[model samples]
Target chain A: MKFLKIIFLISITFSLYAGEYAVVVNKKNKIDKISKKQLKNIFLKKRHFIDNQKIVAINVSANMPLRMKFEKSILQMSREKLNSFWTKQHFHGISPPLTQSSTNSVKLFVKNVDGAMGYLPKNLIDDSIKVIYEF
Target chain B: MSFKLKTILLVLSVSLIPYAVIMILMGSTLKKEYTENTLQEMQTQLQLNVDRIEQYLKTLNRDMHFMSRMDVMNDIYSKDLDKRISYLLMEKKKDLEIEGDFYLFDKNYKIIASSNKNILSDSKKINKFIDVEIISGFDNTKIGNLILDFSLKNFTKFFSNTKSRNYYIIVDKQKTLFLEKKFSNALKVQMPLKNKTNIEIVLQEDKEVFQNILKEYEAWFYTTLFVGALLISLIALYFSNRLIKPIISLSKAANIITNKKDYSYQVDVNSNDEIGKLSHSFNTMITSMSNVLDELKAESENKIKLLQEQSKNEMLEELSSNLSKYLSPQLYASIFSGEQSATLSSKRKKLTVFFSDIVDFTDTTDTMESEDLSELLNDYLNDMTQVALKHGATVDKYIGDSIMLFFGDPESKGVKEDAISCVIMALEMQEHMNILHKRWINKGFTKPFKVRMGIHTGYCTVGNFGSENRMEYTIIGSTVNLASRIESSAIPGEIFISEETQILIRDSFETKEELKITPKGFKRDISLFSVKNENKKTNKIILNEKGLSIVYEPDLQDATTKKDLKKTLEEFITKLSV
Candidate 1:
């Protein structure tokens, strides 16, 4: 039982560690690293358009706690508390985001796409990626 | 099928109808109360939340109006019209420190200036993002318009004051502000319920409420159910024991009385209700029934006792009355016990006995009124006894109208002329009986009575006979029986006697020669003669029967009851004449 508890704790810790997230843009994008205030506004969908282009956001798998942690960290709130906000948006026809899994996949997709933003851990950052904000 | 089960079923049916009605009313009231309370609470909460959101909207409107009146945008519009838009945008960003981004648009809806330094916009950034409602604020015939984007980073901090509450703001331009993380993989966007509508315009804030609501819903369900069950139990207990109890008791008592035939039941009803009244009435009815039954029982007992007493009296009367027909040896003692004490002793002495029969009565009564004939016979016997009592002799029982009387039975004197007096009584009885006999003739009854008598003197027993249980008040000896045989042998209306009687009265009466009769109970043929008159005057008579010679007294032949001898002589004379 103790071993099982240890395994459970380890998995939770790994999940927590895995969700260390930063907002990234394309490597060739002209806008430099933004402040946390601007990043929060973009990620929370306060601004759907930036730099004359529609700002599209990406998401990750729900059961992956890493993805949940990324959402909580970057959005700076609990998932349940966040859903209540979006549920209100459903009447106004404002959806949250198009989502994907794995930091590498999000990075590759963001590189090819314009005005795309998403979160990945710093460990997943590579030379082809541009870090826009961190939480 | 049976009475008791049917009775119980009837009670259950009546009880259930009202119980069902009460239960339905209880359930409906409970449902209505709970629903009204919950819906009112939810509606109040929703209104409060709506007021909170509208307050923020008013604030935004006020802030926007304040910015519209600012001198900074006016300074830019007064400068070179094309050059002033950029300067107005830069200055407006400084003045509106509450909003992070700023933009300026001319009448054509084109972005005129940029605040951020980058290749940030493929086109103009801010003007395209503003809603028509905001644009109209600047559009009402003004020089130009300014739009500002408020900072969303501090949104979570703004909502922290609410209790377990989260919120998001979205502009009409599709700028979304969320203060919480969101679930992405719900196949459908099923917002928690509020008045059957999704909690729109604040998606993330509404999702946080559903978990608590689900718990609250479950708790309210269980709690209300528990309370409802308890209330129903209390209701059932109260009415079943209180209201139904007395009625049930009354019903049971009634059933017990009806089935067991026990009217000894009572009910105690303390309630001042209908059931109590019913109990009181039931008790009254039972009391009445008990009284009636008691009276019936008493009357029945009285009738039985009275009948018993009447039968007892009848039996006593029958016991003492004599049978006038024949000597039924049975049932004679009860009558003989009532006789006077002077009638009996063990030592036998001389006594005179008489016997008689209805002459040819056996042939005469072939068809007759049985009751009339019996009444006629009783009357005749009554007159004969009255005459015998007058003559100081006891009238024995009769065979038909054939009566046997005796003197000195019960009371006899020494050598007194008792046989001659018995002859005179017999003559008077025949004379008196003509009155009753004429009545019999009018009633179409034809029967006649004639008597024959015999007398003798001998030593005999004169008392009751047989035993203490059964006896006859009679004289019995060989001489007495000989007198009875002589009477049987005589013609109707004649008297016969033994030689013994003639010797007893030989000095005072006239006698004829006696004929010997070897009849029943005689050792040899004894000489028997007849007696006629009360005073013996003549003595020149003798009996000659088949060459046996004996003396007879002339006083043995009666003047009236001796008509049979005259008839026989007349028949003889007639035979000679014919």
Candidate 2:
């Protein structure tokens, strides 16, 4: 019973923190501003190029509020609809956006890698990361 | 395998395999065809018609959706929210011209607007609306529900607008209490139920027409399969019977052959195909085999019978030969001539055996004419043999001129008596041949011949000898040898008997003592006797008139070993008187 209570508390805690994600870009890159539509379009694989540079996209985990917001602003569909769509896309040899676990990992990835794009929470964002789009 | 068993198996399998396979295959195919024709096609067509009905329902549903979104309902909505709701019933009717009655309910499910004037009409159909509203709540984009009454009363009023297609609408959201047919006003009713209901759409012309077509197709499919199966079965059965007719007859013939163990049964010959050829071959083979078997059986029986008869004949011949050869001629010849003869059994009686041969009768006959010499010797032999044979002396053999005679078989009249008879017979023969000498003198024949006979008696196996093939009925043993030696040492007409014979005849003869004669197969002289009659002195006068009573020197009997005793006696008188 105690273990169950702990599990229940952990799920609530994850749910509370679910929507808190920050989009991260390389800190050294000068070009910065991006629209939510462009972010959504890039991550959903609907548009390939952004601001004349090929866009790189990433994802939050399944059922997370950030993934929901990402779907509404980008794919413009429910998660079930998105799943069915990706099922079709995978059949056609296309894969969805790359995902990462923690915002700190996204920040560290953007800092060390070129052409890498990802998201984390605002508090986890730092000088090594630049936010291109935030919701 | 026996030829018959192999043939039966071959024929049965040959006939049965294809037939069984064809029948089983036909039965299975017939069943398969029956199921496909009856159910599978119906299921496929049923799914097809169901899909058409679903399509129709979906299209009507879409059209009703478009009607719900029309401007006219909105125009009333754009007006008042209260008094407008009541007048809304009439106006809503005009607005939704395609339906029987149109009604509106607030989000709280209270009747707000209606197209029926029975102001209680909304309550009257409240059940239908309440059921529809409950289902509309969970839908995200859906606003309100709509119901269309397609009862014929209203349907006939708007029939001109929708006359292109024939359809029926049923509102089952509220339970149906009654239905009245427009054409006949005949009502059908059902048990009512509380709201939480269903809707049904019925198409009369197109659906019924299609249903009739489907029903007809079902009927046609079933009837066709039945007819086809029946016809095919009839045709197949007819052909099968026709095909098996010859086989049945053949089977009957085969059964007969098996039961009877006779190969004579044959199948009927018809065509020149496989079956016909088989029948013909069967007939030919069976007939030939039957003939062969019959002939073989007859031949074997004949051979057995013949062998049995041949064996029996051989046995008979052997039996006859045994009977003929094993019986002593002493008895046989006498018995053959029907003579009353007896065998003398001398258990302790003394007897003698005799054997003699001519010195060289073969050399004499070589110089003489064979026929003349034989006649001359036969005339001499006749008298000597008769005397010996007549008095019960067995004339055992003649070796040319010499006579070997024995007493004591074919009846022994006592050995002493036989000796006495033999001496008297010799004297009488000498007298009798003087007459032949005179007759031969008148005919001027050659000099009268002399022949000698020897007699001895002792123990001998005076019986038959040799095999069934060649037999000699005579005596055998040692006593026969002594008599032969004594006779061969004697002169013609001289009486020479062994010491055994001398002892037997002492009373009959005025005996002379034994004179030993040698070089006649004896180491010492053997006693021989001379018989002198009481008129011995006048014997020369009788001898002169007839011939001489010649004293036969014992040595002359040795020379004329096989000469007749009678002729030897006749010539002896002339020699003795000299």
Candidate 3:
């Protein structure tokens, strides 16, 4: 049991250090991966087409840990900074990406919709969606 | 009924019946027209409200479609994260004064942005009144939907709620909105929204409210009709009385004339109508009748006066006929024929007068009862008067048992003829006295009257002579007194004549000388002569003894009397022989 406990602790520590999340899209999308800049531009409504297909970006609810990680790693902005940016973009007739209450709903939305994109934990990603980017 | 009452009834019927009928018909027609017109006006107003609500709903649908097509709707691709589309929706809600909110939803059924921010989530879905899909501006792709939450208050600008009239919404023909209670007895108008067919707008009006307004109109109409009827009745009464007055007065006048039977009463004429003419004619008739009655009364009085005069004349004629019994026949004839007047007047003409007496009448009457003496004297004078009247002598008067007569005054022969009639009348009177003596013997009167007669012929005054009040128609001269004295000197049962009378009768009679004596009224002694019939038949036989006396006249007896006298004499002879 001690050995089993030690192995469980090591696995926990490795998972903490290497807990990766992936940006995903519908399996029918032509793209295998996405750049962080392209993701930022698509989510911010600046770039609308990718590989000749229109892009739709989605997010989990605010205050979600994965949403915070996505903002920190991909959007490269704090929550306050993103909110201020969207507030400014509202004046320009621009909107932020779509949001859902849970990561599962974000994943489901991205898997069913063409040119749809959302972020999820790598473990939760399945064959129904393609991994376009990782963090 | 009285004429006035009849006239009043006629007027009321003539005026009021038609008036009441017209009023009832007009009232009913007006009531129907008023109700229909009021309902039509209400329907028109409700239709106007319905049109306004339909216009409002159409505009709302158009506004939702316009907003969905706008560039701001691109924010739906970002799930309206910047709140741009929601801001526009909030502005439109404010401008429309809606009680609902607007929402934006993505393809995941997530609420992207909403005017009500708390509803912005994937778990919240709104029931929409208006919905439009958002398309991408760059790729022409549907990304999301813009929706309006259904609110009954959204139609408040088009509808104003009142006690009787209210507006409500019916969703899906099942749920009623914006209504406090459901009404069963209400008039309703409904129209569905053109954009949302399941939503309906309804307008309701209370039927009882309209009915109350109609009832008020009915009350006003009936009151006016009643007032009009009252006015017509009063006018009828006034005209009826005015028309009947003259006829009433005429009837009253006719009644008075019949009751009192006074034709003098006249009706008063007050107008130139037919009744006035009738009164005038009635007065004229009464006047004429009164005049006729007066004329009848005067004619009756005149007839009565004529009848009274006739009765008086008849009475006077009867009185004069009774007076004629006391006068001589000659004098009565002369007076009735108007030959002599009844006054003390005498005329001197030659009149022959004669006188006769019952010899020793006083001695004979003193020995008998007065009744028997009067009977015997009337019998002797009646015989003397009969002989004198037969010889045409007028009997003047009777003094006791004497008779005085005259001739040649009222109806005269010659003086010689008058004197001869007097002597003859005296001889006949003497002869009639014997018959009177025989009648007296049959009456058992032993003492019979012996009458003596005297005659004279001389001039005497004759006419009515005496005082004016007492008149006798007789001669009044010495010749009358001499004749009376001559009658006294004659022997019983003898005829005596004066010398003048003997001279006038000597040719027709036999005469013998008699004693001459001077009369008291004569100046010389009057020579007297005894006169007898010249052809006298002596058929009388008489016998007298100490106890028996008999006398008879054969020439004066009929056969039966002769037989009775012979039988009596033979019986007496036989008794004397015995």
Candidate 4:
């Protein structure tokens, strides 16, 4: 009966995180947590390194539903505004981010590379990667 | 082929050919219909199976979709949560009659939970995935993929209760997932399931059913044909026997007649049909031939008998003509003409009986040679007999050189005519004897025959006067004897007749002066006369036994007569002196 109450409390708390996404990184990374602004700056290639290591930020493929969700909840920018920003950054000899076709590939990239970070549905988090931020 | 066998074959073929054709046509048509109907039936059955399998696949996809939306996927952060998901999938698998495993993959590309509870093998990882959908929360946050290792048995099991002659197949895009069995030839129908499942259900029918039907039809067709032909043959043979029996018998009967040459044999008529009528006609012809043969035989026998009789009659005529030579013509005519019969009998009638003998024929015969005498005698008698026959005298018999004959008994005129014909016949015979004498002298006969004949008219018995076997047609009694006496008493070369004959012949003949003599058969002297010519001039001179008497007219004696009388007186006186 107490276990049932504990499950009920967990369900209540998870409602607060509804429509939110978690930014994950490999467990080997030294950063235990990260601010959404810094993560967005890293995904936009404004900061290329973190904790004296090179940072590799992963994005899902263009038009992927998860990628659209991640862009809306984390990047906080319209598609047209991001398209101009990436185009400006592409001229400055900086690529925006590396993209994967599915959330599974984004998770695999984060788990295998150090200092790498990606986002997925919050219910899809597993032990192979750490959530550095949530959106 | 013999006639009967050919006829039988003809009948069998005539009846059976059409029957076999019809049977074959019907059998083939029925087999075609059966094949079409069976194919249609199998197609409908395969469609029903395809529909059921499609529906079953749809139901499995629905189950899989419902299971994917369960609340356990949102507990990915909890410990032992993967084990809980696997247990829940196992429960669904039992309820849904599913035959394969289920797997739940997290967003990190790891199988977080699976119903198989084993490490992912390579072969198992290549399993057919059905209803691969995202597991999501109420916030539409993307979870991992829910994968069902879809079982084709659930699809193929729909046809498990079907016949052995059918198969069911399940196929996806790349490979055939499940099939009941392999099939080379089949009638296949495919049905794709509704949306989420990428599988097709196929139904197929084996070809052995149609092949079996064709074999059965062929066997039935040949069997029916054989039986029908046999029946027709037997029936034809029976009828041919019925038809040919009479003809065979007729030929046999004809052969018998030809070989034996007997037309009396008849064929049996057993029916009133045309063959029977033919037998009747044949029998009738035989009977007619037999009748004609019998008639011909009888006619030929009669002809032979007539021929024999005719030949026998010719022989009898030849014998009778020969015997008639020894008989008198009157007697021969009378007997042969059936007027007289030869018997020992006599009848009295007025007959002119004549008898004649040669004058001193014995003395003449003794002087002449026997051959000459016989020749002279035959000539004299043949001539006399001919003369007598001309005068219608019945010549009776010849006594040496004498002839005894009679007229007026077998045939005659009145008594006076009879006497005259007898005397005339005697005169003619004398003339004929003179001719014979002249012929004999020329033949160097020294002495010739002299015949004298006498005639008498009296009532004498003149008939066949001998035994029945040896008969002589002659005249008998005193009249015959007197005729003989008169013939003997007459002078040589003179014709003498009795007074009865003289009285009858007096008018036709002249008589000498009547003298009186007594014959041995008479009791008194009978007057006899020497017949002479009546037309001579009369100089009556009579010489009696003692004296001479003369009465002559002196005018009648001429000078030659006076001289002859003087010379005769001198010679007479001189002979008287001697």
Maximum-DockQ candidate: 3
Q: Which runs of model 3 end up more than 4 angstroms from their true locations?
A: A1-135, B1-3, B107-109, B120-125, B135-142, B161-215, B260-578
Best by TM-score: 4
Chain B superposition TM-score per model: 0.41, 0.32, 0.48, 0.58
Better of 1 and 4 by lDDT: 4
TM-score versus the correct structure, for each prediction:
0.36, 0.28, 0.44, 0.50
Q: Quantify all predictions' global Cα lDDT against the true fold.
A: 0.59, 0.55, 0.76, 0.73
- Ten-residue segment with the worst summed lDDT in candidate 4 chain A? A10-19
lDDT tens per residue, model 1, B132-168: 2222212134645555544544233334324443455
True contacts kept of 4: 0.00
Between candidates 2 and 3, name the one with more favorable lDDT: 3
* CAPRI quality band, candidate 4: incorrect
Off by over 4 Å in 1: A1-135, B1-165, B169-179, B183-226, B237-261, B269-285, B323-386, B389-578
Q: Candidate 3: deviation at residue B390, Å?
A: 30
lDDT for each residue of candidate 2 in B201-285, tens digit (9 for 90 to 100): 2222223444455567567656765665566656655555656667777787888988998786778887787878778888898
- Regions of candidate 4 where Cα sits further than 4 Å from its true position: A1-135, B1-251, B269-285, B342-349, B383-393, B408-427, B462-465, B472-475, B491-495, B498-518, B524-578
Q: Between candidates 1 and 4, name the one with more favorable DockQ.
A: 4
Model 4, B1-578: lDDT tens per residue? 76767766777677767877887798878878877887677678767776776677667677777777765553332312325677877788777777888777666656767777783744445465574565543335566777778666655566654453655455555567556566676656556655534466565666565566568877887787788767776787788787788888889899999999988999999999998999999999999999999999999999999899888888888888887767777777788887777777788899898999988888878887798778777877788888988888887888888888888867667676777778777887777777887887888875666666677889998778767777788878898888888888887777887788888766556776445678886998766666663313445332211133233344567999988977986998798799
lDDT of 3 by residue, A1-63 (tens): 999998897677557544588888888899986777999888878898898987877777788
Please give, for residues B1-578, the per-residue lDDT of candidate 3 as tens digits. Answer: 87788899999999999999999899888878876675576567666876787787778778888887876665554455455666777788888777788887777667877777577454345667667787765457787888888677767666777787787888889998888556667767777766567777777777677667667877887788888889999999888876776676667766876787666777777778776777677778777886786687677877787777767767766776677656677777788788988887888987677787777878878889999888777777777777877877788888888888897878776676677667667766767767877888899897766777777777788877777888788888877877777778888778788887777766556788798898775678788888875433365543322256444557789999999988998999999999
